[model samples]
Target: MPAKKPFALRLDEKMMQAVEKWAADEFRSTNGQIEWLIHEALKKAGRLKDTKEGGRMKDEG
Candidate 1:
């Protein structure tokens, strides 16, 4: 696992509730769900490059 940095995140009350519900449905914590969502979006957009070591962002020139 890579190091994780903590940061403050503001979300609308309703949206937060929805995310919490979705997370429970998926048997994951809200934070994990958020991370998974971000990972999926990045993969879909070709932002996440897979390396021999594993999934990691490509190095910038």
Candidate 2:
């Protein structure tokens, strides 16, 4: 697994409430929703790498 990084985020009350509701509807935690949002945005912007063989992980002997 890749190392996880920590950062601070600020959201307005209205946006935060919307995200919280959406997260519940999707059955994902708030943090997960935020991560998903970021990932999707990056992918939409063509900044995410394509899934390929190199992206797969192999078990070590």
Candidate 3:
């Protein structure tokens, strides 16, 4: 595993609220949920290369 990198992500109020609710319902941190969404999208497009998951974890881990 590599060291986790940190950066700022700006979201509109409405979008942020939706993501927050979804994350809560799924018992995942907002960051984790977002990562999972991105990972799934990449997989659907055949862009993920990492065996461990290209840029995200498979679970809410």
- Candidate 2 whole-model C-alpha lDDT, 0 to 1: 0.82
In model 2, what are the clashing residue pairs, if there are any? none
Q: For model 2, how does the per-residue alpha-carbon lDDT over 11-58 read when each residue is reduced to its tens digit?
A: 999999999999999999999999989877886787766655665523
Candidate 1, pairs of clashing residues? none
Clashes of 3: 0
As a TM-score, model 3 comes out at 0.74
For model 1, residues 1-61, the per-residue Cα lDDT tens digits are 5799999999999999999999999999999999888888887887865653345444321
| lDDT (Cα atoms) of all candidates against the true structure | 0.82, 0.82, 0.83
Q: Model 1: residues >4 Å from true position, as ranges?
A: 52-61
Model 2 residue 25 CA deviation (Å) reads 0.2
Indicate the residue-level lDDT of 40 in model 1: 81
Query: Over the full model, what C-alpha lDDT does candidate 3 score relative to the true structure?
Result: 0.83
RMSD of 2: 5.4
- Tell me the spans in candidate 2 whose CA falls farther than 4 Å from its real position: 54-61
The sequence of per-residue lDDT tens digits that candidate 3 reaches over residues 10-54 is 999999999999999999999999988887788788786655566
